[model samples]
Target: MILSVALSASLALTGSPAHAATKPVTFQGFTIQVPIQWHAKKEGVNLRVITGVCSPQAAECQSFLLGGPQAVKYASEGGPYRPDQPYHPSSGVTECVPVKKYNSGQATRVRTSKAVFGAGQRARFTEWKVSCDGSELNVASYTQRVWYVKAKKVIVVDHWKTPGLGGILAKAVWS
Candidate 1:
């Protein structure tokens, strides 16, 4: 229920760096084929995937999140909260916790990288999650920010605070 703003690098689909093989994780009627090495932790309806990144800023940690409510939020873009924006607790969201919001104009970024995917269930609540590197979370990037939706929402988790990683999270989809 913690709504925080986040982003990574922009996806250069034309010729981006491909990682390991794809192993798709199916949950809640959707399949997520993330890099084969990522490990998954199933907690009730949410299947959390832990991905590895080789970087000096942070290593042996940081991952890409797949499946669960958040993924549905981005794929459909019809949820209740937008990326990085100040959170307004919605009735559909029963678990959201209040968190400090950054005032650096998240609305503009939401408009730019906004995307909607998946057909999740009739959302009973909107859940906000921020990607964490180790124990810290809410690292900011230029092209990422808050976005708003009409109904309940979900999210995909990502590490790093640059716009580059954000691109991969947005484009990645499960078959």
Candidate 2:
């Protein structure tokens, strides 16, 4: 019985993660609806799904961050920061995930995000980036995200920033 119980516990952890929460919380000015797993902190939140992690697949993470809420440069020597030339460290990134680019045109729609159609209001796969004052990005960021409504809930999930995978928290969704 003990062995069986241990196996079950392991399955719960290793098995497929539970779908995210589907509630919208209004902070500052913007309204964001996300899953429960994507817990909201004082700043932003964190969620995970079939996206990139800190282990690998970080190359694709760059294309997601269009910019930041602030008027700062991204891949250059300036305000927030710039990519390290050699042996880049992953300590800078604070929060990294996809965001909802509501006003994005069709041109960026194809590359910036992914759509998940559903019965009711479809959850838009948006990129979520960290910011200083809902303007300038602080650290790392995510490339993209998958947003969808499951069981009448809007949830957003993606890869957790890890080593090698790097941090990507720029051009986030905000008010």
Candidate 3:
């Protein structure tokens, strides 16, 4: 009995069950592999809708928003939609970053670079660190991967200090 218990504990600790295959979750016209145990939900308007997902214990969920090139219609300086912007990876970071962070204080765009996702699709990747006002113990940080596919669509992948999720986005598959 002790041996069985130890074996079970080891399996749980090693997360052998969590290594099962990950199914692809589709949002808008794009699809990406959501890591095991992550949850996804779609919200917002047709062109502005985003399928967001996060680990159960995560503080913030990541948003997967994809739209046609003409979907740049920003309702406000920080609204989730941008109808005036072009199709670029950086554009996704600009539109997807919450406006409240900017309104609170200065948010830094820490880094930006090029990336590839899903069958060699090129994209723009960016990272941000937001320093809020006051003595708040927690601050906001984000990493975004944007893909402007030849289909004339823009795909934005947003995460908050969550590692590996971006890697899943990097392996996204378009249908």
Candidate 4:
């Protein structure tokens, strides 16, 4: 009985083996565990988590972004990004492809659902698809996922499709 209790305590403290390689990342009043290799950087009023390869010239590299009310208010081409609205991170032509002269068109919402974060905190989750335009039309495409907590005015934007990120966010803890 004593051994079982001790093991239970250990499990509670360290989590499962799958989480052994993760580290807690805090933003605003929320925290989530992400792979230890992921690097977090502060960008303006937002926090960006670098998950994969990135380009120095790309406006948005392969990573995710965490933002507060201020960042959300001006997230889209200096406009607001409401939960019910479409996502438009930038205006005019923006670089979607790392290669030179490749640009991206508008982003359209493809899927949306209710998501949970930070100890059952509810959020609006959405996926947007954008097409890359270069020498040929619709050369390539990418998906951008977003989770918005309206009451808290917090948002998580992921464009790189980082594995297990959604599950990590679902298990977040709020402070």
Candidate 5:
């Protein structure tokens, strides 16, 4: 009886194993474990992961994208998307901020570092701060986090600031 009580306490303290609560999501030969509640869909050459509430009309919604080489090649309507450059999907203005009537302008790189993915793969991690301007002045700002694996031609872009995402990527298992 004492042993059973102690075992229950230990399990309660440590919680369940991470994998028990998560589901593996694979994209472009890379795999990461995300919460089971998250939904994923294929959009062209990219895998779109919806993490939160999103609107159909919103230009940028509450989600992230895992892109392959083909997706990168045509990320921008005007030209190819470069990891070093700011994320501009089109030449025209895009409403990135959740608030209506606000338009996004040039995004500036705020941070850059090396991020590890499945196995021992290293990626260029960049955080961009994009300003959202109203008709008169800047209304708000948001960060765009990107992990680019040049060797595998895979990129992960996140604008919703999903919790524990970096750690999840770090613990990924590549296939």
Candidate 6:
């Protein structure tokens, strides 16, 4: 009884299998694990899916974008869209440039940095701070981790930045 109790305590402290709350999901040609509260939706004609913290229709939301085929080709910089090519990390860094609007009483500020994605993969982290003439303001930040998994012919984008999004992406399984 003492041994069992000790083992249970250790598992709880280490976040063992019993403590993991995520569920496995298969999309496009890869599989990943996500929290039960999160939901996935198919977006665009291409093999793209957006998993959000809330329902897709929710007003305030953030999501992870998973794209297939052509998306991988377009992920690289300095090249035309070529569905047959893979993404090259050395090509260039992705930027987060939001166009400033004309007198909309709203201004947006974007900040970009380098962050680690799943398994130490380099990713672009962007924060968009939007404020209006009024007292209301919003800051949205997400990490776009794009990689061309040649075997799968897809470029998975783990667009994290919201609460719990990074944890979900950290445990993601591409296969």
The lDDT values for all models are 0.38, 0.31, 0.49, 0.79, 0.78, 0.46
Q: For residues 61-92, what per-residue lDDT tens digits would candidate 5 score against the true structure?
A: 68888888876666565567776776556678
Better of 1 and 3 by TM-score: 3
Tens-digit lDDT track of model 3 for 1-175: 9999999999887667447556667765567766545555544432222235444534334444544433333322534333222223232233224424432334456666666667657666655454443345455434443444434355563444455555665777766
- Which candidate wins on lDDT? 4
Rank by lDDT (best first): 4, 5, 3, 6, 1, 2
- Per-residue lDDT tens digits of candidate 1, residues 1-175? 1232222233333223465356766654445456656677774454556665444443223444433455443342344344344232222322111121322222232233334443332222122332322234454322223322224334443432323334334443433
lDDT of 4 by residue, 1-175 (tens): 9999999999999887685687888999998888887889998878999887777756566788899988778767778886655455566566674443467765678999998886859989998887666357647677778998888889898877778888888998999
Q: What CA RMSD would you report for each candidate? A: 13.2, 14.3, 6.9, 6.8, 4.7, 9.4
lDDT comparing candidate 5 with the true structure = 0.78
Cα deviation at 12, candidate 4, in Å, is 21
Flag the better candidate by TM-score, 2 or 4: 4
Candidate 4 TM-score over all chains jointly:
0.80
Give the number of colliding residue pairs in candidate 4: 0
TM-score of each: 0.38, 0.24, 0.56, 0.80, 0.81, 0.43
lDDT of 1 at 18: 68
Segments of candidate 6 deviating more than 4 angstroms: 1-18, 45-60, 76-143, 162-175
**Model 1 residue 39 distance off true place after TM-score fit, in angstroms:** 1.3
Give the per-residue lDDT digits (tens) of candidate 2, residues 15-134: 633433345544323344444333333312322222222334232232212122221122122332222121111334333233333111111222234343322233334443322124
Candidate 2: stretches off by over 4 Å: 1-21, 43-175
lDDT of 6 by residue, 44-80 (tens): 6343333454443232235556666656555545443
Q: Model 1 — TM-score against the truth?
A: 0.38
Better of 5 and 6 by TM-score: 5
Q: TM-score winner among the candidates?
A: 5
Model 3: how far residue 85 lies from native, Å:
11
